[model samples]
Target: MRMEQLASRLTLKRAGNLVCSVCWRRYKRSSIVHQWSRYWITTRAQSPSSRPSSSLKGPAALGTQPTTPPITKKQFPSQLELRAVQRLDVLLEDCQEFLQKEVVPTEDTILDALKTCRKLSEYFRSVKDQPALSTIKPGGEAGNLLFLDADPADTQTASSRTLTPIAVGRMASSIAEEAMDKIAETIKRIAVDKNVYITSKVLQEVVDILCLLNRPESLAYIFILYSSKPVPKPNQRPLKYTKANPDRITAAIPLKVAERALDAAIKVQNLPLCLDIIEHTVSTKAYKRAKTLRGAFLPAVAVAMTPGAAYIVASRLAEMQEAMSTSMMTVIGTAGIITYIGTTSTLGFIAVATANDQMQRVTWQAGIHLRERLVREDERAFTDKVACAWGFADPRRRGEEEGPDWEALKELCGIRGMVLDNVELMEGME
Candidate 1:
């Protein structure tokens, strides 16, 4: 009877019929145990040590651990930084356009624009390592300020578009005096700081602008910064041209600076500055070498006839004449007279002779006879000075020591006897 009851209960439960509570509980317990067994088996199968090496090689595996994603580096500016740069670009563009229209901005406005430009320049230098703010053009009616890059083709056309102005002209107008003062200050600072952006060419352009504005005092300050100790600050006082500071523009320029400034002054026809540089060159013994003396002579004489520059001209000419005489003698003693004359004539000696003739004419016209008398009076002494100036060893002192080999010296002088005769024959034919 018990077996018959049990079998009947089981059949009812499996058929989904009503069952006793104890039998239902027993059925749920068995289902739970089966699930637990399956889970334990899965856990053992997925153990990392039990996994195959090939399976672990790929990114996904049965027992693969969760990995932290790689950290990436940021290479470029952020959106906010880029937006700020764009704003700066727009500000510079507007400032440039305003100055290009020949309308000088007020002192405050100019300063603000310059500050923006400098900030942008600093940013560019830090980020890009280039002179970002240097592309300013001095454009407008007078065109007296620094110029910006322009299309070469557009320059010939009346329909050419106006260029962007990067910086205001120092002397754009009389009111720009304060702006000019600030520029001078900035330049001095740049020089002291040795800022690479303000290149020698850029400094030259600044000097050119100062010269154009007729600011000799400020120009003098620029030249002084090149070679003097304790660079003097730019004076805020208005520059005044006066007799006391006649050559103040080039007053403290060093030899190298003076040489370059001479060319610039001559180009602009700044007679006083030219003469001042010449005097500096002479007084500094800067022309002690034959190469430098030769290089400076033509340019010095080119301006010698200018009113107050006559003395400078005459002095340079005398020195040059003396040097030439000494060089000629040295060459003749070493290479024979024919080779010396031929060599000298070819290498600008003819030009120097012509310049001498021109100098005589200029002196005659200007009523300057002192230089002529001085040259004539000290001819022998001048020759000796030239010889000494060139550091030539005295043959007399050498006594019995062999002098310079004439044949060797002649070869070095570069003309053969045959070539000389051919040239003479050609001249005769002509």
Candidate 2:
């Protein structure tokens, strides 16, 4: 009985070892085949020298019977490998369809489609002859993918003949006006709900589109909408006013956008739009607001020096003064009436006494500043012309009386006897 049990145990152990040895050999063979397959694919893909010959010949052409047949696309070694290739192909087709059919192909949708293509390409990278993986290119057929293509001739004609700068501006304004309703609704929602916030990127994109369209007026409107603080209600407690933090708001216009709008407004001579931008920038406490305002305002006021413009400037300045007065009254109202009278009377006296004097000084200073800059620019231009003429003129005429006389040139230019700084002339005008 003991001898029979030993023989049975030895037989079981031997059987287990044989099974393990066979499994190990199978695993080793699979690993070697995988390595060779990967190396062959890589070499063929990278170098034309290693590629299989296109010509077909009999086995006797090499003077020996064939040992192995060449692999083909339809004859993948394993079912799993074949399935993976098929899956990658299907995924690529799906992505192509999605890109073609997307109604509003935004940046995100395009990126998602590219990501799908990339994954599929990586999976089938070992398939050296696969055209689908190799042919795929980023932004291939972009116009078709985004559905943004129009007839080139029609687009050119429409843009050149029908879409003038003014028409473009009007179209941009209309688009911005349509967006304003949505933006206002968002703002209201954010005001009501503390957790709600606007996406900065979306707002920036809107601003960018408007600027690209050259719609300064619309951009100024956006700036004004965000910069103006809400008026406090009489029945409700006042909300604490913190310094404008862009991160906290549902929608905050950037100072650079305001600057760009201001520049565009100046370029198109849109005075009202320029003024609106200045007002918003000042209200928002944008950095360097005063400097930007002065730069924009001086050029505009200097260019449009008509009586109507003077009246507009005067009216705007008066409005500013009135706003200041109202703010003072509000502060005084917070205290008792007795203190209000003393403070109000004192402030009123000071304001009345100095307002006219300050206005005159400001007007004089602005005129002088503009005149100085103009004179310097004119001098530089004159110097440059003189240098160029001297450098390029005939050397033989260096000492001859060929050039125009300075006095004669001045006379012809209508400044022969003009005195720039005559005290008697200034006093007579006054």
Candidate 3:
């Protein structure tokens, strides 16, 4: 009977209908506890005590003070800085356009634009590199401000466009008195800071512009800068325009430009500046030796003329003694001395002032120093634009024809006896 009962219990447990007494008791207890927990949670949510703690409030909760967000300082554009960038941009564009067309901007346009550049540069410095600058509008592609890159792809156009605004502006007409200081500053930046190669054309144009502006002193300063290989800062390591400092790096500027610069200096009566330009221009060894020899001009002329004057006076005195009264002799002697002295003095003056044999290959009066240099260098293009500002003869129709008028040049220069002899004229004469 006991075995049968045990077997029946095992079979019931395996058949999945059997539940353990301990498990049934635990289930009843869990159901009651769950009900009670749900009731407590609902009550807690309704009560004000379950609200978020004030101690857990924001950034202040982590032992930190509550603070307002930082204010970003606003940037305002400087009128000067904005104006400078805009003016520079436009001027550069106009220059590039003119270069592309193989033409030049009008004198007025160039002058105004350059003045703007000067003003811009002035303002930039006056502000002491302030960050408050206006944003420049997107224009065409930005160009090289210092120089034009040699583009191999467009060789033909490249040669034509071998110029920059700085180059063009440096050649512009009539800079103002106030803006004069800025010129050296700008050039120093170009020469020292940016350190770009100033082309021959650019330098030639500078000569032309300086002539127009009547800035011979400035021209002399520029000539010195040109003479330097990597141009020095103004007043720093200043190079002397002397034969001792022969230009080994920079290309020699065309003789025509030198002539123009000399003319400008002479017009302003800046003799020292004139001499400096002359010294800087001519570098040949023969000229150097000849310059040294030229120191004897006064002595030579004095020696030659003193005897002639003495002979005339002595001969007059002897003749008067033989042929006239004391009073008449006195008058004749005085007249002869005066005439001889005056004539000799005048001739000596002319020779000293105008002779090419002097230390200065070209004198202030002769105005042919550069031409002489060209001839000595055996430069073939003696009549070219770089040599003289004339074509062989007038190409205009007869009545309207305008050719090289030596008289007009003389009158324009206002020099009493201006002698302009070009290599072409000399060659033709030969």
Q: What is the C-alpha lDDT of each candidate?
A: 0.33, 0.35, 0.39
Cα error, residue 29 of model 2, in Å, equals: 82
A best-first ranking of the candidates according to their TM-score comes to: 3, 1, 2
TM-scores of all models?
0.26, 0.23, 0.27
- Model 2, span 1-430: residue lDDT tens: 9976533322101112211111111221332122112211111232444434431222233344444323322122222233333443454455446434413234454344334433333323322222222222222342123223322321221133323434333332332333333333322322222221223443354444444334445655555444443322223333333334422333334546555656666566554565455545433333334344544586466445544443444444445565456445444433344354456756764554333221210111123343333223222222223222333255333223234443332232232112212233232345
User: Mind giving the per-residue lDDT tens digits that candidate 1 earns over 302-412?
Assistant: 545343343344444445455457544444343443344446645654344324321210111123243332222222222222222222355333212233432232232
- Pick by TM-score: 2 or 3, better one: 3
Candidate 3 lDDT, 350-381, residue by residue in tens: 66544444221111344445434323331212
Pairs with backbone N, CA or C atoms under 3 Å apart (clashes), candidate 2: none
* Native-to-model Cα distance after best TM-score fit, residue 230 in candidate 3, in Å: 3.8
Residue 167, model 1, lDDT: 15
Q: Highest lDDT among the candidates is held by which one?
A: 3
> Model 2: how far is 25 from its true place, Å?
82
**The best candidate in terms of TM-score:** 3
Candidate 3 RMSD computed on C-alpha atoms after optimal superposition onto the true structure: 31.3
